[model samples]
Target: MGNKLFAAICYGENGKKILTVKCEPEFGIYLRENYSDITLGYYMNKVHWNSFDLNGNVPEMIIKDMIEQSINWY
Candidate 1:
């Protein structure tokens, strides 16, 4: 296997992890289904995590929203 490429980490109140989100799961899934640049989390629970290609076609607003959601969800 190779090294995982994660954009950010989401931690819980006690500093435990909630998920490693590349983008919000729903949007990530849509990107996965509709595009070739997004994928499920490299080493995380696929249902709740996703890995996005930052060099891909995703928008800045969406990326910001995803990061916010990741933090909010925790």
Candidate 2:
């Protein structure tokens, strides 16, 4: 990606895999509303980042889409 967007992966206190990605706050709002597992970025800025379970019920393709979309947000 040409943009310098920040992204990362880290484990939470519960030992679950978390994927953090940079994204538009508006889009993050949409995802948070539609996906039950999405949360305001874990230990990150809520408006610029989002974090979700790598193995949760949000579906595999959607997660992949999110990851791809995130890298392009900036």
Candidate 3:
């Protein structure tokens, strides 16, 4: 899967997830601000990466979009 997004589980923490898509920096900021579940990606560049709570308020569509965006990115 050239889908670079579905890389790996940042850790064994099944509740949170690392970003799979290379989205705009502005969008990443917005996501972290707008969603309580979103945050800077684990051990990654704060400006270019993001992480989210899989069981939080983030809508299913948003997660799907991230996956799709990652597919295109690779």
RMSD of each: 10.9, 1.9, 3.1
Best by lDDT: 2
Per-model TM-score, in order, reads 0.57, 0.83, 0.68
lDDT of 2 by residue, 1-74 (tens): 76475678889978999889877778899989999998989989888889998887888877877888886665
lDDT of 3: 0.63
Ranking by TM-score: 2, 3, 1
In the range 1-74, model 3's lDDT, one tens digit per residue, is 55255323465275454443455678777877888877777766667667766556888887776666545554
What's model 3's lDDT at 4? 50
Every candidate's lDDT: 0.60, 0.84, 0.63
Q: Report the alpha-carbon TM-score of model 3 versus the true structure.
A: 0.68
How many residue pairs clash per model?
A: 0, 0, 0
Error of 3 at 43 (Å): 1.5
lDDT of 3 at 56: 66
lDDT of 1: 0.60
Q: What's model 1's TM-score?
A: 0.57
